[model samples]
Target: MTATAHETVRDAGRALGIPDPVTEAFVRLLRPCVYPCLYEQLPEESRKHAGPAARAGGSAHLPVDVVVPAYVPHLVTVDCAAIPTDVLDIDFPADGHVAILAEITDQDAGFAIHVPAGTETVERRPRETEPDALKPCASFPL
Candidate 1:
């Protein structure tokens, strides 16, 4: 079964034009990082779905924020110092998007961060719900 899953992943990676070695390396990295992050939320028996599933659960759990830094040369800052140190920063490369899953309680409403895209900016909307605009695809399930 393990071998079959590995083959499935490898085949999918190949179909997407990723080399076998790179795909293997990514699988190695995600295996260690992804589970531990989810585990931090709760014990195994009481565990809900991680990543997007948790985000879809709405007010019952934390909201997942996807931060996509522009490709042009500039800085896109995300400061979470006001929040607890444990949930401070989400590490993502400048060229990639990072998913930040945070648990909001009744005592605290939400935190603010200023995300700038070059010289232009957009108005802020409700943070909890996904926008009504057209989506490229349905949520990417892990």
Candidate 2:
């Protein structure tokens, strides 16, 4: 029997040592956006530039941090409640991408989506503070 995409993602999360609750939440939140059929079912208002706003709100409340690790993206810290809802009006293309939301330290909380340029998988660890270093613990890929 073939493992469904959702199962595969769940397995990946387990293999990466992500906690069960965080993995489950990530899968739940990602289901609508990752699958085309599910994506199509979303309200029209949600399909337009909702990624950033959703990311901001979700990251602030949840213990998980969403990120695309292959691109080595930098974390963007912001106060979710302080973000204006008008951010949804910014026209940008966000398609065919899925992020992994992992439970990380409070200092590591942030958003980090990037256009993937390589195949390196993101590994989460305690972040070390350095003036010009890339912090890898902020995010990972699905």
TM-score of each model, paired residue for residue:
0.24, 0.22
Q: Write the per-residue lDDT of candidate 1 for residues 7-89, one digit (tens) a residue.
A: 88889999999999998987665431222223355666655543322111111111235342221111112222222234223
lDDT of each: 0.36, 0.41
The predictions' CA RMSDs to the true structure, in order, are 14.8, 16.6
Q: Determine which window of 10 residues in candidate 1 has minimal summed lDDT.
A: 53-62
Model 2, span 75-114: residue lDDT tens: 3323233234343434333432223333345655434333
Candidate 2, residue 75: how far the Cα is off, in Å: 27
Predicted model with the maximum lDDT? 2
- Lowest lDDT sum, 10 consecutive residues, model 2, at 54-63
